[model samples]
Target: MASQSLAKIIANQQLNSKDYRLLISAPQIAKEAQVGQFLHLQCKEGIDPLLRRPFSIHDYDRQQGEVAILYRVLGKGTKQLLERRPGQEIDVLGPLGNGFDLTNTADKVVLVAGGIGVAPLVPLAKELIELDKEVAFLLGAANELELLCMGELEQLPLQLKVATIDGSLGHQGYVTELLEELLADSYGQVFACGPEAMLAAVQEITLKAGVEAQLSLEKRMGCGTGACLSCVCKVKVQQGSGFEYQRVCSEGPVFRADEVIFDE
Candidate 1:
């Protein structure tokens, strides 16, 4: 279920040079939001940036009736979003898209995030921890400066590993390299959200190891709902030797890692 509301921006703070954390007072959406779900925000008042921008729910405070989204200034839409002040009202269509399924019997779960893809995984980590599941995180970025949200992630009770291309951080390589090493320990399941290259590597690693893995994808969307047919990804069908285009906004943003067909 989804709801549309004019939510008040309670807090909008810059996390880094490019990324920001936006907290909004939207109880209806917060209560219904799940890990891996997103919110579609009408960024500006005018029609200049007419279409809404989709942002993953970074974290949500159920008791406080608030939801937060982590985003970076990538274009006109997000730049407009950044200019919005606290107490300003923004139209939010929320708690959308299919989220990660936590019902599996995976005692040891691993979360892999690349760049700002760490957003949705925050809530998923919290939920998994609450279930008494042992969890670990492999966070990677191009460099230390691009690595976002380390402080918030450290507050959780989980094993954390960092990787960077410039060797200014934990490991001096791709996060997938760290993941490969960790996979040797035999994690029951893995959840990943990152660039296509990262996800493809994760898919190969998980497939070879016979581990269950879910991947969250990022795409340009026209409508957050399925009507616009804007955000679609190729998914491998279960029964056939063919692939089908599935709506990333409605059918998923999360899909089985092995089922995703990444462009080479």
Candidate 2:
């Protein structure tokens, strides 16, 4: 079951002016957390920022009872997180949201990410590697500055492809272009977590390629729990021709590509 705790911040370091990595000692969450799950963090002491900010579970070590949260400071909630120092306690409720399914027959897998959304994929890639699966990681960001977790990702035993809009890195365009080339090689599955437009494009590409894919969605949530019904997304019903709203917090954050109904 999901529970709340005051996770002790072991280190909260700024990777750059915009990105941060917070390592916390939360045994409860660390052992239970799976790839693509998230943490609902109380960004500040007071209620000025009411809703707890949800960040993808970036990385974790069950032995050490630690979890990492890599986040970009896009708004007030995230901006406030920067002030937190080591030795402080952060209120956290997590290992929430459904995680990506790893039980597949596919041995060759492609991992796609956009900006900070790459957080969950790092762990997913590592886990896939341990299972003796061939993994390829494709990452996209506006520029070199937005690319998160490059150091950790580079250390993994997998193929890495990067793309930045300004041509600061690998390819001079979207990372999907890399996926297109890889599709020819007969990969087993694709897993992606990123911007909506990018996910939609990935869904189309993989569907046309006849490859299986799982997508981790991002949404602004009112309550990290299932209550309040704030973070609902349209999903194609299993038995219907139309769509039905699914709770992104409870039903997913990760859902099969065909199940999601992306806005056109």
Candidate 1 regions with alpha-carbon error over 4 angstroms: 46-49
Question: After best superposition, candidate 1 residue 128: deviation in angstroms?
Answer: 0.5
Clashing pairs in model 1?
none
TM-score of each: 0.97, 0.97
lDDT of 2: 0.90
lDDT of 1 by residue, 1-264 (tens): 567789999988998899998999999887898899989999985544355999999988889999999998999899999999999998998789999988864999999999989998888999999999999999999989989878878998999999999999999999999999998996999999988899999999999999999999988998788988888999989998899999999999999988999877
RMSD of 2: 1.2
The local distance difference test score of each candidate is 0.90, 0.90
What lDDT score goes with residue 71 in model 1?
Answer: 90
True-vs-predicted CA distance for residue 240, candidate 2, Å: 3.0
The CA-based lDDT of model 1 is what? 0.90
